[model samples]
Target: MSNDQPLKGQIIIFTGTPKSEDVFELVEQLGGTPISLPLIQVSEWIEPTDEQRLMTCPTYDWLIFTSQSAVESFGLKMKRFGVSPDAITSQIAAIGTRTAAALTKIGLTVQFIPTVFSADVFVQEFKPTENETRRLLFLRGSIAGVTIREELPFDVDEWTVYSTEKAVHNIESLKNLVQTEKSSTLLFASPSAVNVFSEEIAPFTGWDTYKIGAIGHVTEQALIEKGAHVDVIPSTYTLKDLVLELIK
Candidate 1:
C-alpha cells in the first residue's frame, strides 16, 4: 500500500444516504472502495395542517431543524406554496453544521447551533432571544424523537415534514457483500438506520464480522445496545469526519 493511501484495500460500506457525493469521493481519494447500502429512505410527508403551519412559519419566534432531510422537504414545500425566503421573519436554529448549510441553501440564515449535534444537548445550550411569546416550530421527520418538543421550555410545535422508512430492497445486496467480503467497515449515520440493520441484516451476518463506525454518540449507543462493537466514532458528527477517523 502506498503511504498516501491509508485505506488501501479497505471496503467501507455506507449504511445511510450520504448527504453529498464528496463523502464517497473522499474515500476513493484515500484509496478505499466506498459502497452505498442505504438502509433508510427519506421522503416528504406533508399534511394539510403541516402545509398551513409552513405557510405561516414566519409567525413563530424560532424555527428548529435537526436534519438535512427536513430542510430539503421544507424548501420543496416553500416552492410549492410560493413562500419566499424573504417572507420568513423567524430566526433559525440547526442541530448540526450540515443542517445549517442546508437551511442556508434555501436562503434562510441560521442564528443558532448547538455545541453538540444531539437534540438533548441542543435544548440545554440553545437560547432564544427573550420575547413575551416564545413560540417555536420544529420541522422534523415522522419518526424523529420528541426531545426538542418535550424538553424545551418554550411553546414548541412540531411539523412532520419528512418520513423515514427502512430500505428493505438493499438487504439482499448487503447480505451478499457481508457474506463475500473477508473484512469490511460499516458506517452508520442514524439510529433509525442502525435499527433497521440490526433487525434485518445483523441476524444473517452477525455483528462481529464487520468493523462498525458510528457518526455520533447516538448511533454508537444504538449499535452498543444491539451488541455490536463500534470500532470508530469521530469527534464530530459528520460523514466526512467519520471517514477521516476510519482512515486514522
Candidate 2:
C-alpha cells in the first residue's frame, strides 16, 4: 500500500442499486477492495398512468426531481414517447447535486438544487409563500415518502414513474460472504438498504460484528431502527462524503 492509500486492504461493501458502481470505484481509488451487494432494485411502474398524466399535463410552474432514479425513469419514458423537454415551459428543480447532474447529463437544465441534501431542506428553501401557490410536477419513485408533497405550499401533480424494492440474493452466498468477509465495512445509502439488510443479511451469525457506515440522517435512522450500530456517518448525505468519512 502507498502512503496515500489510507484504506489499504479494507473491504468495503456498498449496499445500493447497481448504478452505485461509482461508489465502488471511489472505494477502489482509496485503496479499498469494494464489494457490491445491491440492497435495492428499481423496476418500471406497472401501469404508467403517470406517463399519460405527463402527456396531457397542463403547464406547470416547476418540475422537481428528488432522485437520480426519477430523472432516469422520466427521461427514458420521454424518449420513448418522442417528447422533448423543450415542450415543457416549467422550470426544473432537483434536491441534490447528483440529481441535478443526472438531469444535465440527459440534456435538461436544473434551475434549483438545495445546498442541503434532503427533500425537507429542498422544500424549506423553495416552498412558496402564502397566497403564492405554484403549479408543480414531481417525478418520483413509488416507495418515496410524502414529505415533499406535504411540505410544499401547493398541491404537487405527481408521477410515479418507477418502483423500488429490496433486492434478493442467494441466502447461502450471502451467508458465505458474511462469514468470509467478516471484517468488511458495510455501507448503507438509504433506508431500504438498511431494511433489506435487517431482513435478509442480519440473520447470519455475528452480523453486528461488521463495521457499518451510513450516508445520511434517514439512512442512519433506519440503521438505528434495525438495531445496527453505524460506525460512520457523513455530515453531508452524498456517497463521496460517506467514503471520506469511512477513510477518516
Candidate 3:
C-alpha cells in the first residue's frame, strides 16, 4: 500500500469489453491495479439482409442511431453499397451525447436528442408532431435487447447495423483471476454483463473477496438477483463518475 495513492493499492476488475484503453489508463491514474476481467464482448458487424434492405429503401422520414457502433456499422454497409452518406436527407436522431458526436463525425447533424439515453426515454420524449409521416428507421445492433421493443408504435423499419458477440475472454480471465486472492472490485456496466459474469465466473460462496460495483439500477438489480455482493453505485451513468465514486 502506497502512502500517496488515492486508491491505495486497490484491486479492481473491469467487467465488459471496453471500446478503448482510455478507461484502463484512467484507472491506473487513480492508483488502482485494474484486473482485466471484462465479462461481455461487443463486435461491430451488420447483417447482409439488413444491409440490402437499407440499400433498397427509397427514403426515410427519420433515422435513429442509438450508439457509436450503429453509426460505424451503417457507414460500412453504406460504403460497401456505394451509397453516399450525404444522400440521406432524413434528419438523424441520436440516443446520447456520444452518439451525437459519432453522427457529426460522419458530417450528419442530429435533429433529435432525447433527455435520456435509453430507447424508452427516447420514445417518450421524442415528439413527432412536426412531421405528418410517422416513419422512422432504427440503426442498431442485433442483440440490442428489448430497449426498443415498445418504443416504436406499430412498425418501424429496423436496420440491423451491427451484431453483439459474447466476448468470452473476460470470463476466462476472470476464472483465472479467481484462482488467486480475490481482491479486485468487479465493475458491471449493464445487466447483461452481470449475467455473463455470474454464469461464467465460478461460484465464490464464502471464499470470494472481490467487491462488485454496478453502474445502474438495472445492473445492480441483476447482480443482487443472482446473489452477488454489490458495493457501490453513483447517481450518474458515466464511467468517469463510477470510477470517481470508487475513489471517494
User: Which structure among the candidates has the greatest lDDT?
Assistant: 1
User: lDDT per prediction?
Assistant: 0.90, 0.79, 0.70
lDDT of 3: 0.70
TM-score of each: 0.97, 0.91, 0.83
User: Can you give the lDDT of residue 57 in candidate 1?
Assistant: 88
Candidate 1 residue lDDT tens string, 209-234: 87889988988999999999999999
What ranges in model 1 sit over 4 Å off? none
Clashes by residue pair, model 1: none
The number of clashing residue pairs in each candidate reads 0, 0, 2
The C-alpha local distance difference test score for the whole of candidate 2 amounts to 0.79
Residue range 1-248, candidate 3, lDDT tens digits: 56456765677777765555777777888788876666655555655475567655447788889777788777776677777767777878888777787778777788988765656677787777646346777776877756664566534777776776667755666777756745667778777777776766647433246676776666778888887777888776556667777866
* Cα misplacement distance, residue 180 of candidate 1 (Å): 1.1
RMSD of each: 1.2, 2.2, 2.9
lDDT tens per residue, model 2, 80-189: 77778776656788988888888888778888888788887888898544543567888889889898889887788787888998677644555567678767888888
lDDT of 1 at 13: 97
| Maximum-TM-score candidate | 1
lDDT of 1 at 226: 96
What residue pairs are clashing in model 3? 16-38, 16-39
